[model samples]
Target chain A: MIIGALGPEGSYSEKAVQIWILRHRLDSVGIQYFADIEDAFLAVIQKKSDLSIVPIENSIEGSVGVTLDLLHENGVEIVGEIVVKIEHCLLSKGGPEKIKVILSHPQGLAQCRHFLKKYFPEAELRSTGSTSHAARLAGEFEEMAAIASPEAAECYRLKVLLPNIQDRKQNYTRFIALRAAGKNTAEQVFEQVLCDTEEKTNRPENSSHSAFKTSIIVYLEKDRPGALYEILGAFAKNKINLTRIESRPSKKELGDYHFYIDFEGHISDAIIKETLKDIKTKTDTLKILGSYPAFKA
Target chain B: MIIGALGPEGSYSEKAVQIWILRHRLDSVGIQYFADIEDAFLAVIQKKSDLSIVPIENSIEGSVGVTLDLLHENGVEIVGEIVVKIEHCLLSKGGPEKIKVILSHPQGLAQCRHFLKKYFPEAELRSTGSTSHAARLAGEFEEMAAIASPEAAECYRLKVLLPNIQDRKQNYTRFIALRAAGKNTAEQVFEQVLCDTEEKTNRPENSSHSAFKTSIIVYLEKDRPGALYEILGAFAKNKINLTRIESRPSKKELGDYHFYIDFEGHISDAIIKETLKDIKTKTDTLKILGSYPAFKA
Candidate 1:
C-alpha cells in the first residue's frame, strides 16, 4: 500500500500518516512524497497511491485554501482524519546570536511573528517550500536558523535553539486522508482502522452510531439575500451540528462564492440523507466530498 | 494625509492607494510602506498614518486570513474599498531563454503556475517579499526573471518578457481602506469621497440608501447545531444580502471559529441596526467593523 503525502519526509503530514499506521498496526505501507498538496491529492486520483494525507486546516493559520479548492475540484472521498499538534521549534547550527537569516515555510514564519520581532529583529526572513526544506537549508549555513518541527531539527542535525516558538501554544493542524472516488482499497483500510479503534475503545460495532463527519460543497444559483441562510436551514432543521463552514471564491467574480461545510453526521443516516436532499433543492450544485469517522483527539 | 500600505513601492496595495487617491482627488497623500500586513494595520492604530490600505480578498486566492484576523483584533474600521485588476507580467533583464530562476511573491507565483510550468519547467522558482522586490532582483541578474505587474517592470528597468501571464485572466483583488476607530478625519474624507461619487454618477444625496457594505465579526457562545444558522437568520429575516461569509479559527482549538461576515446595508439603516441587535443576542460577541460604500468595479 502506498500513501501520498507532502514531503521531504519530516512534514506534519508524514506524522499524521505514522499515527494512522500505528493505529491500524499496518507495516507494509510505502510513503510517496509530493512537493505540493495538489500533487499528493492527484496521486490518489491517478491510482499511483491508495490514499493521500494532506493538511486541511491549521488552528492558528485557518484553512488551507488550496486543499479546500482541490477537494471541491477533484473526484475524491475523504476516508479518515488525523489531528496533529503543531509545535514549532527554532533550529540552528550555531547559537541565536550568530543568526543572520531566518527561514521557514511562510506559515511557520507567520505563526512565530511575535517571537521573531522581539528576538531577532535584524535577521532577514526568507520563505522555503516547506518547513523541512527550511531545516535542510539551515543545516548548511551556520548563520541561518529555521522554524520547523523538532523532528525536522533532528533529521537535519540542527540544534534546537528554541522549542514551541509559535505565537500561540494551542496550534494544531487537521489533515484528511483522501482516496479516489469509488475506490474500495482505502475504504477497506478505513474500516479496519475503525474496527481497531472500536476494539481499543470498547465501542459498539455499528458504524452509523459512531461520531462521523460529512463534508459537502454548495453553490447557489442566484445571489439572493437569503439563499445561504435557506440552504443552511436544512441542517439546522435536522438538528445537525456543523463542525466547519467556509466560503471560497467561485472564480467567476469577486462576490460569487462556493461554500464548503462539514457537519457531524454520516451520509448514510436517514436524517442526513433527507437534509442533503432538501439542501440540493435549494442549491444550484452540491457535491458530497465524503463521510468519515471523526478524529478522537 | 499619510497612507500605510505594503510596499517596496510597486505592490498591488500601492496601486489600490493610487486608485483611491485618484477617485478622491487628494493631492497631499503620502504613503508609508511596511514589510507585512500586520505592521501596516498597526500603523493606523498607532496614528503613524491617517489611513492604511491592505488587500482584503482576491477573486482567485480568497480572503486574506491575516487581514480578517487583524480586523477582529484591532480597533480599526473599514472606511473605503478599492478593487484592482491583476495582470501579471514576466520581467527580466535578458530574454526568456537566459532565465534560470523565476522569482515573485508566493501569490504571484501560484497565480502563474500553469504558465511557468508550460514555458519554463526547468527554471527554479523563488519567493520574494513582494512582486516588486522580485522585479528589482531580476534587474540585477540576467539569469533571473520575475512575475510582477507591468508597472514593476518599468520601475525596475526590466523588460516585459510576457504580459498577462497569470493562469486566470479575470483576477481581481479587493483592498480595504482602514482608519483608527473614533477618528473623524477618515469619516469626513469618506463622506467627501461619497459626495464626489454621487456627483459623478448623478445619484441622489441619501447616504443611507446608497450601495453600502457592513462587515462584522461574530463568535458563538456555544457549539450548537443552529448557532450560526440563528445568527445568519437575523440577516435573512431582515432581507439583507450577504456578499461574503468566512470563518477563521479563534486560535483556541482546532474546531473553534469566528465568523467574519460582509453584507449589504450600512450600520445606520434602521433595519440593519435591528438585525444586528437581534444577532448580538444570538452570539457571544458581535463586533461591527464599520460600513463603507461597496466597490463599484
Candidate 2:
C-alpha cells in the first residue's frame, strides 16, 4: 500500500500518517512525498496513491485554505482523521550564540513571534517552503537556526537549541485521510481497519454511541437576508451538533461565499440523511464530503 | 492627520488608504508604515496615529486571521472601509528572459501559480514579507522578478514585464480603517466625511437608504447543538442581511472558535440594537466592532 502526504519526510502530515499506521498496525506501506498539500491530495485522486494525509486546520493559524479549497473542488471522501499536537522547536548546528539568521515556514515564524522578538531580536528571519525544508537548510550553515518539529531535527541531524517555542502552548493541527470516492474495496478495508482499532481500544460496538462526524459544503442560490440562517436551521431542527463552520470565497464576487460545515453524525443515520435532504432544498448546491470517526485526542 | 498602514510604501494597504483619501479629498495626511499588521493596529490603540488601515479580507484569499484575532482582542473600532482591486504584475530589472528567480509574498505567489507554471516553469519562487519588499529586492538583481503591484514597479524603479498576471482577474482586498473606541469627536468627523462623499455622489439624504455594515464577534458560553443557530436566529428574525460570517480559532482548543459576523445595518438602528440585545442573551460574549459605510465598489 502506498500513502501520500506533504513532505521532505519530517512534516507534521507524516506524523499524522504514522499515528494512523500505529492505530491500524499496518505493514508493508510505502510513503510518497509531495511538495504541496494539493499535490498530495491529487495523488489520491489520480490513483497514484491509495490514500493521502493532509493538514486541514491549525489551532493557532486557522484553516489551510488550499486544502479546504481542494476538498471542495475535487471528488474525494475523508475516511479518517488524526490530530497531532504541534510543538515547535528551535534547531541549529551550533549554539544559540552563533545563530545570526532564523529560517522557517511563514506559519512557524508567525507562531513563535513572541519568542523570537524577545530572544533573537537582532536576527534576520527568512521564509521557506516548509518547516522540514528549513531544517534541511539549517543543517548546512552554522549561523542559521530553524523553527520546526523535533522529528525534523532528528531527520536533519541538527541539535535542538530550544523546545516548545511557539507563542501558545495548546497548539494542534488536525489532518484528514482522504481516498478517491466510489472505491468500494478501499472503503471495506478502511472499515476493517476501524473495527480492529475499536476492538483494541475496547470501544462500544453500537454504531449509535460511536463518535462520527459528517462534513458538507453549501452554496446559496441567491443573496438573501436569512438564507444561511435557514440552511443552518435544518441542522438545528435535527439537533445535530456542529463541530466546525467556515466560509470560503466563491471566487465569483467579493460578498459571495460557500460555507463548509462539520457536524456530529454519520451520513448513514436516518436523521442525518433527512437533515441533508432538507438542506439540499434550501441550497443551490450541497456536496457531502464524507463521514468519519472523530479523533479522540 | 496621520494614518498607520502595513507598508514598505507600495503595499495594497497603502493603496486602500490612497483610495480612502481620494474619496474624501483629504490633504495634509501623513502615512506611518509598520512592518506587520499587528504593529499597525497597535499604533491606533496606542494613539500614535489618528487612524490605521489594515486589510481585513480578500476576494480570493478569504479573511486575514491576525486582523480578525486582533479586532476581537483589542478595543479598536472600525470607522471606515476601503476596497482596492488587486492587479498583480511581473516586475523585473530586465526582460522576462533574464529572470531566474521570482520573489513575492506567499499569497501573491499562490495567486499566480498557474501563470508562473506555464511561463516561468523553472524559475525559483521565493517568499518575502510583502509584495513591495519583493519588488525592492527584485530591483537589485537583474535575474530576479517580482509578483507585485504596478505601483511597486514604479516605486522600486523596475519595469513591468507583464500586467495582470494573477490567476484570478476579479481579485480585490477589503481594508478597514480603525480608531480607538468611544472617540466621539472622531466619530463625528468620520460621519461628516461620509456625508460629504454622499453629496458628491448625489446619494439620497435619507439615512435609512444609506449602505452601512456592522461587525461583531460572538463567543458561545459553551458548545451545544443549537447555540450558534440561536444567535444567528436573532438576525434572521429581525430580517437583517449578513454580509460575511467567519470562524477563527479562539486559541483555547482545536474545536473552540469565535465567530466574526458582518451585517447590513448600523449599530444605531433600532432593529439592529434589538437583534444584538437578543444575541447577547444567547452568547457569553458579544463585542460590537463598530459600523461603517460599505464600500460602493
Taking all chains together, the TM-score of candidate 1 against the true structure is 0.91
Candidate 2 — which residues are off by over 4 angstroms? Answer: A97-100, A117-124, A184-205, B97-100, B116-124, B185-205
Q: What is the lDDT of candidate 2?
A: 0.83
On DockQ, the candidate that comes out on top is 1
lDDT of 2 by residue, A1-297 (tens): 999998887888889999999987999999898876777899988998999998898888888888888888888988889999999999999999999889887678877877987898778677665788889889999999999999999999999999999989989999999989864422233343434431222223576623988888889855677888888899888888889999998877788898999888776565776777678678988887877889987
TM-score between predicted and true chain B, model 1: 0.89
Angstrom error of the Cα, residue B276, model 2: value is 0.9
Model 2 docking tier (incorrect/acceptable/medium/high): medium
Provide TM-scores for the models: 0.91, 0.91
Span of 10 residues, lowest total lDDT, candidate 2 chain A: A195-204
Supply the TM-score for candidate 2: 0.91
lDDT of 2 by residue, B225-289 (tens): 78888888998887888888999988898989999998887665557757776786788887778
